[model samples]
Target: MAEWINVKDIADGAKFYAGAAIRIMPTPCGLEEGNFIPENGLVYLISDNASDKSYFNCVCLSAGEEGNVICRLERKGNYVLGSEIKRMFESELQEAFISKSIEIAVI
Candidate 1:
């Protein structure tokens, strides 16, 4: 049998790193440069699931922050939703990362 692992440990593995925290500065949905709501924001991380190797999408989800905008990409069934994946890219629009997941392997 496979080694049993705690969900917290598994979730902790998926970290969504952002440039800055939402609490540091409060900005509107547009021209904010990050995808996460302050206080109750979504975790955001940049993955290589973009068309090009330089661009990435910001995933959202309903999870608390372990720190900053990084959280575990909650896996459900056999698929994971963008919202559950705590990771966002540097953008001014919050909807830019909507319905998209980084196709790059999590290093």
Candidate 2:
């Protein structure tokens, strides 16, 4: 199995991106979220560097109270989701890059 590093170990220059929200269509089976990217458009996740991920042209969530739950884009200095990890690092070196945790820096 591949080694998974904690969110903290991610590099500072690492790039992270998110997928766009797609309107769900009601069907007999169930509603399905569209693919990460639409046809003839940029893919949500790009494995080019496989180390630093980049997110662009996507609707970023904001800090707002819609109801009881608050859903927003990742802010700086917070742990990122597993989906934000673009590359895997050596297990031994993970600790050196991070101490407590890491976050998604949107720029």
Candidate 3:
């Protein structure tokens, strides 16, 4: 498996290669490898070292009275709206839907 490193952990002036990918997650929560993109996170294909990488998307959940549900949404290109993840989290009651424990390291 390709190593998945947290962007926050990357040192300044770190190097990258063409065709490499960056996982654009709405939140800082980690994602497991081999899962669908947007289902957990969005993947940005690096066009080159010159490709700009920045995203400010967010997830809006329905009110608690609505059972913390996510409103239906349309897919945006290759990315799944964060609403779907919120729905998965709510449906699973957050039990291992994301992760049950915090990870101090990335692989």
Candidate 4:
């Protein structure tokens, strides 16, 4: 099973690569990472560098790791709608998701 995590929680000060699988919660304005628990349905991917105190730059999740995910992106070659990341500058949006399988360093 996969886990839902808050980027802010795991972002301990390391860089999250693009295409990382993650679960996120839907908001009135947009979607946001929910928590730091593993769950199924990898429905989001990190689209850009996300710091511990920053918002996510992600898209809908897909199969495989970063390499595989990148291939999927190349095949699709189009922007995913309704999957845009929000609250980039807000310091109150406490939501993030990351896979426990992936190794992360604590700072």
Candidate 5:
């Protein structure tokens, strides 16, 4: 059984969003200087099953803070309408995240 991490645990601002939670592909590096590799795991909901998967998206504001990493929405935050995922704005992503609709992974 895989563990489900609450968004509120790592990013303090995520509980405000709705859909919720993610499994991790753990990494041991710092996400700084625009350095991120998507080879790591995605922020996906186990409840959402489809031919094309949906994943939460976030921009790391600060990763140096222990236990409480800071993040905002990605410019193209993961937005799904019906079976299609769309490219949305960062603030829109923030809304989704704040409403507890999304969860972020630890870097």
Candidate 6:
């Protein structure tokens, strides 16, 4: 099984925009280590399990602090209808992370 971290745990300076596609990364070493990698087509949702595949369309209710990020994962499809996942970091969906940063270019 893969180790998971909570968004609230490391959501101090994280940035999240609703309706915008975000990504999530997995912590191979666990939350204590605070290490993560970039994951494609995956977003952190409100859950304890880091490997939860169901909470894919979770939306961020708040923004994060500034500095080194722990993980990075991206939301795959279009969020036209909005995110299915809801809840706060300390409550329901606590397990979430941003593995890495991806650069987007405007065409």
CA lDDT for candidate 2: 0.28
lDDT by residue (tens digit), candidate 3, 1-107 = 33555544444334443233344444323324333224344433323112223222222221222222122223344333334333333321112122211222334
In candidate 2, what are the lDDT values of residues 39-92, reduced to their tens digit?
222111111222233322222222231122112324233333333332331222
State the lDDT of candidate 6 residue by residue for 1-107, as single tens digits.
Answer: 22334444443434433223334434444334543333322443221224644233343322342223223233333211112222222222123443333333456
Model 2 spans with C-alpha error above 4 angstroms: 1-3, 19-71, 74-107
Q: Candidates sorted by lDDT, descending order?
A: 4, 1, 6, 3, 5, 2
Q: After superposition, how far is residue 100 of candidate 5 from its true place, in Å?
A: 2.2
Q: What is the C-alpha lDDT of each candidate?
A: 0.33, 0.28, 0.32, 0.39, 0.31, 0.33
Runs in model 6 with CA error above 4 Å? 1-6, 9-18, 30-104
Once fitted onto the true fold, the runs of candidate 5 whose alpha carbons sit more than 4 angstroms away are 1-18, 29-38, 46-99, 103-107
lDDT of 4 at 37: 22
CA RMSD per model (angstroms): 14.3, 15.5, 15.2, 12.1, 13.8, 13.2
Best by lDDT: 4
- Model 2: how far is 89 from its true place, Å? 19
TM-score of each: 0.24, 0.19, 0.33, 0.33, 0.20, 0.21
* Cα distance off (Å), candidate 2, residue 9: 0.5
Residue-by-residue lDDT tens digits, candidate 1, 17-92: 3321121112375435453456333534433333433333333333454323232333343334334433422334
Error of 1 at 73 (Å): 19
Per-residue C-alpha lDDT of model 5 across residues 1-107, encoded as one tens digit per residue: 33443332334222222243333332334233232324343343323223334343332322332233223222123433221121231221121112224434567
